[model samples]
Target chain A: AQSVAQPEDQVNVAEGNPLTVKCTYSVSGNPYLFWYVQYPNRGLQFLLKYITGDNLVKGSYGFEAEFNKSQTSFHLKKPSALVSDSALYFCAVLSSSASKIIFGSGTRLSIRP
Target chain B: SQTIHQWPATLVQPVGSPLSLECTVEGTSNPNLYWYRQAAGRGLQLLFYSVGIGQISSEVPQNLSASRPQDRQFILSSKKLLLSDSGFYLCATRGDPGTRGYTFGSGTRLTVV
Candidate 1:
């Protein structure tokens, strides 16, 4: 079964500091990885995805993720974090042949001003 | 240009009461629809998904049920709501084949007392 793991439950960072949220996935075939952000009481918003080609994928709101095939990781990163960037981040993986995507447990990102 | 509309945005229901949540899609046709529940504003738990009208696939067996009567309409219902069902419910649609990401609705905050 395909699964996604987000190791950190919460990450705290100062405003303007770099931030990283770790994610790892396990799948049988080619993996379609995605990152989503959710605010309190709201649904998730798509951030980025890695389907093929580029290992470093850029996404909405100055976010980027690196897909490491050998390590089975797709980590979300931002060069400079902002207070508005604080939210719940989820990493999901979908196999090409699968019908649905598998989501990670989620990581709470807190950016202090 | 795909969009998902889920309502009522917020809901309060007593335990054992019947519940219904509706979701509709626009700017797309025959798209895959999904229903997910987020507990405590954290990880998402996929409840159901459908590829076409009248084709529902359940991921977890619980107090909720989903139906797809129209190509763009999806409904989540429960005969008797439980206290545990109180959470944020999200409706989503799979994006185009090239993107392979999901576009989510604004979400419905359901509080079952």
Candidate 2:
């Protein structure tokens, strides 16, 4: 079965420090990977996506993700962490064969000031 | 610009009560509509999706059912609510396969008592 996995349930980082949220995916054929952030009581906001081409994809809110086909991972990263960036992050992949997008079990990111 | 709207922002219903949540997309035509549920501390689970009017594909078998009577209107309904159904529900629309991420609405919080 096609699936996405966020190994960490929570990741903590101090403000101004670099942060990473790990994600791995299993799917048939090329994968369309995405990252989304959810604030308290709000719908998910798209962060970035890696469809094709460049391995490093940048998106809204100064977030970026590196897509590695060999490792089957698309990890979200930020150069510097911010208190406002603390939220639930989800990794997703468009499963073409299943005709749906599958999401990982999310990782809560906490940035301490 | 395309926008998706879902309402009501929050709902409290009694167990066994019928439920209706509506979602509509603006500034887009014949777009793919999707319904997703996010339980507390969990990832988004796709409920249903529609490519066109009257075309609904369910991702999971559950008490919830979805209908698309118009091109841009998607409705999620349940004949009877269950305590397990209380969660955050989100509506999303995808336009142009080239688009990287789906546009999500501001989500609805449903609480079953």
Candidate 3:
């Protein structure tokens, strides 16, 4: 079955430090990878996506993800963490053939001031 | 600018009660719509999706059902609510023939008592 995985349940980083939220995937064919952030009870907000071409995809809120085909990973990263960036981050894979998207278990990011 | 709207930002319902959640999209046509549930702020579970009117495909078999009465309108319903159904429900949309990521609604926080 096609699936996305966020190995870490939580990631902690000090404010202004570089942070990374890891993600991996198992799927058939080329994958359309994406990252999303959720704040409390609000709906998810799209961060970035990798459809084709460039491996490094930048998205909203100063977030970017590196899509590594050989490793089957699309990890989210930020040059500098912010307290406001603390939230639930999810990695997803879109199956165009199946016409649906699968999400990972999410990683809770905490940035301490 | 594509947008998704989900109603009833928060809802508290009793067990065995009927449930209905609505989602609509704007600024796009022939869009693919999806319903997802997040349990305890964790991973997202794909519930249902619609490629077009009257073309609902369920990702998981559960007490819930979905309908697309119009091109841009999607609705999720349950005959009887279950305690396990309480969570953050989000509606999302992706444009057809496009590689962009999905746009999600603000989500509905449902609590079953």
On DockQ, the candidate that comes out on top is 1
lDDT of candidate 3 over B25-109, digit per residue (tens): 9999989899999888888888998889999998888989999999999999998999999999999997542445788999999
Candidate 1 per-residue lDDT, tens place, A5-65, comes to 9999999999999999999999999999999998887788889999899899999999999
**Over 4 Å off, model 1:** none
Q: Model 3's DockQ?
A: 0.70
Residue pairs whose backbone atoms clash in candidate 1: none
* Candidate 3 residue runs with Cα over 4 Å from true position: B96-99
Q: Each predicted complex: what DockQ?
A: 0.75, 0.67, 0.70
Candidates' lDDT values, in order?
0.93, 0.91, 0.90
Docking class for candidate 1: medium
RMSD of 1: 1.1
Model 1, range B1-113, lDDT digits (tens) per residue?
A: 99899999999999999999999999999999999998888888899999999999999989999999999999999999999999999999998636748899999999999
**What TM-score, over all chains together, does every model reach?**
0.97, 0.95, 0.94
Q: How do the candidates rank by DockQ, highest first?
A: 1, 3, 2
Docking class of 2: medium
